[model samples]
Target: MKIVFYGVITAIALSCNVQAAAIDFSTAWYQVAQKNDALQAKKEEVKYSQALQDAAKSLYLPNVDITGSYTHFDKPISVDTPPVGNFIPSFNVPLTNQNFAHSSLNAVLPVYTGGRITAAQDIRQAQVDEAQSNYNLATRATFTQLVQYYFGVVLAEQVYQVRLDAVDALADHLNHAVKFEQQGQIAKVERLMAQVSLDKAQIEAQKSLRDYEIAKLALTKMLKQQDSVLPTTPLFVNNSVTSVTPYLTKTLTDHPGIAILNAKREQAKGMVDMASAKHLPEVMLYGNYNLYSDDSATGELLPEWMVGVGVRIPIIERSGTSQEVVAAKSSVRQVNLLQMQMQQDLSILVEKTYAEMSQALEEYNSLASSQALSEETVVLRQKAFSQGLSTSLEVADSQLYATSIRVQRLSASYNYVKSLAQLLSVSGDIDHFMDYLQINGIEVK
Candidate 1:
């Protein structure tokens, strides 16, 4: 019966290993980039902004249109001349027919718009820049999330393996205790105590398994994968200490949030220019060609074609152009202040994340010696227990202590990984995260 139970467990493990799709960090990032809806939405927004920019450029081109109209008068338009002392009979001269139809092709080209066109173009360009920055920000956020879920799975798997090992060790100890009790070499209480520890270890193993499954599910969902993912990248830590100065510098210089604010400031400046332009005169070149005229009188009255330059000067305006300029200037100030605040916030975030990463690294390094000693103690206690020189409780405690140290070390490594991702994310250096991994990472054993 025991053999069958072990066989079933082995089969299930093998099946899971076969069904799971192994993915490396680069592959996972690529999948997320291709499949994430939010990232795609941001990309579409960039395209939309670009289209608007193109439309703004068209303002520099001439606008042409064809117009046609038909009108009916109450009666035929005519003029009658009275006879001069009956020497000449009265005569009627027709000015136009009762119905008239006319059609024309008209064109207007902007010679100058008091800089309104240029200002509009500048505003649109700034909007494009802002949209691009937003997309970049979304990309960074998505990649950071991927790092968390991807490494989270690795950490959970390592923990579950440690738990399984603990359960296996306790089962061996329990088997030994049972034999010793049957041989009258140990008390029955010792055997019962070993049984209880094994039971608890098994329960802990089940909990670890559940955690692993949850972590895997999160990663799979992020990548939009139908199959379970087996992360090939192990959780890693850097032994060398890193300074936070570079990260702070990068954050202040290259962060997307800062870029967004700068674009907004440019947009506000353009708005100010546009509002000021409204107070100046506009110049345009316009031309029209008569396409058709149904009445001969109308055709004779209207010119066949005409071309002229036109100017529109604003003598008195009540459209609040001054107020608009003031509002735009205020917006500029607001954006500048926001940029400053974002810089300060990002710097603080970088510092905090760096400290946390360093702390986790330090903690992991500090536990190395303790982990070694715990393992050694576990071996010694187990040997003594088998020889009737130590109690089952002592052996169980040593085993549990070793397992605890291992789990703690794994947790510390996981924390370090997450913190590193966050630090890079804030610093706008997340694109080079893989390079850092290659340079400083040590894979967990």
Candidate 2:
């Protein structure tokens, strides 16, 4: 633990003034979010549950205890004038016992616990399963959020780059317009229109740059660092062959939320059995050995050993036992209802996120084509303007359309990757998602 803490501290020192370092989806999801403080706390929770499971095993083992006592009498204990004294008249019978002490060691082995031990073991196992499920849930949720912030920052950067490109393109157009107007080939109004377009592009570029900064700051927080996030991976998708059907079953079986509900249901069932077990009997086997010391005129037995069996049964209870049994069974019923509800909710989430991903990918493909066409249009129009075959308005309009389509294209690409991440998380398979990235040449290091 100390090593991990110091490692993060050292990384923080290096990152504070570090240059832009490339970070990938797998690195951020596995290294940063997986080691976040909250997720680490859940890891501790799993350990605690394991410890309880170990404790439950001791219920079947024997326990040993040591006890000692001392007693003092001012006068001493005397034997009453007895027949032994009369029979031994020749010998004087004295009675004075004082300063007595005894030390004993006792051990008890449970022979039967009325099914309590079995129930306890079941409950502990369920607890361990629940903790594991919770840890899994934490892992998925952390990765989900990190994916959003990671790609969000990248998307912002992309948008800013596009805006920057537009500003530069518009600046060139403005310069050409000025030269044409000064040469008396174009009117002053055309030059003014070019200036207006460049001004607007510059203003929007500034806003995009600020937005990009904000997104990077958000990613930094998610990474729990003082440095900026530099997403090295590009926003791309080639998961056409990957469909949503294969994952539905795996999601139902492996998703942590459903696992949690199932664990709770089992725990409730254990409680019910434990409550019923309270009405049965318990038995134990015990052994004791003792050492005694006494100063007495009448000697006593000094050391002794004893072994015995014990049993306990609850003879009667008014409504306590029955009421507990009733409540525990009802709790089982409640958990069952919750399990059903959770399964339905999980299915809905899976299907909905899958559809969103498909739609975003489709939108990205369409906008990408539009952006290509718009880029070609801008180039041809600018060439025409240079040759005196087109006006500055035509060139400026083409540039504006190009920028708009590029912005939309970047947005759609971000949504596609973001929704794909969501789908992977909903299906509880971020590792597979990482694999998909690698398969598509989006290296994660």
Candidate 3:
């Protein structure tokens, strides 16, 4: 007994060591989630905001530009030449090429813009907001897909294990029946039935193994990795269903759709501000300097600058600025109505998810009981067969019934998990199922 206990301990220690050395599924899933493509896209969106904010600063700064031009006149203008019909004294006048080269540096500094610059800057800011909201939505989609694939692979592995166990049990039963037949305790028909059961179990196990491989490959592809020998151990998934009503409410209030609508409405309001400002006069301070060489030497090489206030009052209004204001107001009202509709839809989705989860839980519980009873029935049928009271068909039927019950149990587990996912998806946050998401290294928050 001591020797057997020591062997078991050594085996368990070795298994633990192997597990530690192997690539853990938790870390693998974490790496996958961290490097998701959608997250990368979201990170890129921050640059758009940075650029727009920088552009807004342009409104507060003066605009400066440098320009240079060169002009060459082949025939110079000579006032001494006379051309007449009667007394045509055609005097040959000498002309030289007149080459003009000038360079100027000019600047425009806005002393006041009647708020047009500010309105334009606000419009740019609204564009950044729209990009930001789009990125947020993309991240949500990527995270949800990762969750679905991760759980799917885990379920496939579980089913594979169940099939493997069935194969082994059937093989053992076949060997025992053949021995009993040789000793004349069981008929030839019983041995043949056992052999056929073992063959069917093997076939089922092979199909399940193939399915498991395919599922593993799919998950690997999603993680952006090459095909690999999948980890023998299954991924950890938390089956617990936690409350998500508060999160759902927050999501409805703060979702990307709402953000986009708000940004659009804000942009429309800024447009109204811009149009109204068009009616108001804009004031700008400007300065320029120039030097002329031959054209009467009009300007000196010294400084030339001017600072003044400019204004323009609209004497005639073609497009009513007041109409633009009214239109913008109407748009704001439309967006508000849409937001209300979204909230109502979200509420209905939450309720439906809750109902699905409840139903899944009930089915899982019922299947669990069925599996337990089927297992006991298998044991009783096997004993009856050994005592020569039950036929081969009866034993086979019991084993198949037990297998079917196990399959149902697995299906129930999958259904329950999927329903939980649906609930989290509508809630717009999966923190309630963070334990399952932890496989991909995603923190709930």
Off by over 4 Å in 3: 1-26, 71-101, 180-192, 227-244, 291-295, 300-303, 312-334, 425-428, 435-445
- State model 1's lDDT: 0.89
How does model 3 fare in lDDT? 0.66
Compare the candidates by TM-score and give the number of the best one.
Answer: 1
lDDT of 1 by residue, 137-197 (tens): 9998998899989999999889988987887788789888888999999998998899888
Residue clash pairs of candidate 1: none
Better of 1 and 3 by lDDT: 1
lDDT tens readout by residue for model 2, 1-445 = 2234334433543453266557877777766755589999999999999999999999999999998877777866655543455564443344545666667888999998888899899999999999999998988888788878888888887787787678778888888888898899888988889988887877787677778778888888778765676887777766553677866777888888888878888888888888898899989999988655455543355447899999999889785988898998898889888878888887888788888777866776777678889999999999998888988888888998999987887777777777777777778778776565667533211
Each model's lDDT comes to: 0.89, 0.78, 0.66
lDDT sort, best first: 1, 2, 3
Write down the worst ten-residue block by lDDT for model 1.
1-10
**Over the stretch 1-445, how does candidate 3's per-residue lDDT look in tens digits?**
2234334433542442342223344555466557877767666776767687687878878888876767777755444667787788767553333665666677778877778888888878887898888777665565566555665666666676676666666666776787789999998988899878877866676676667667666667777765442443333324455565674776677777778878887788788788778678767777665532334222233345544555556667878887877787787788788878877887777777666766766666677678888888878887887788786667777787788777666665566566666666555555455455454422210
Q: Please give the distance, in angstroms, between residue 165's alpha carbon in candidate 2 and its true position after superposition.
A: 0.7
Assess candidate 1 and give its TM-score to the true structure.
0.95
TM-score (C-alpha) between model 2 and the true structure: 0.86
- Against the true structure, what is each candidate's TM-score? 0.95, 0.86, 0.75
Model 2: per-residue Cα lDDT at residue 4: 40
For model 3, give the 10-residue run with minimal summed lDDT. Answer: 292-301
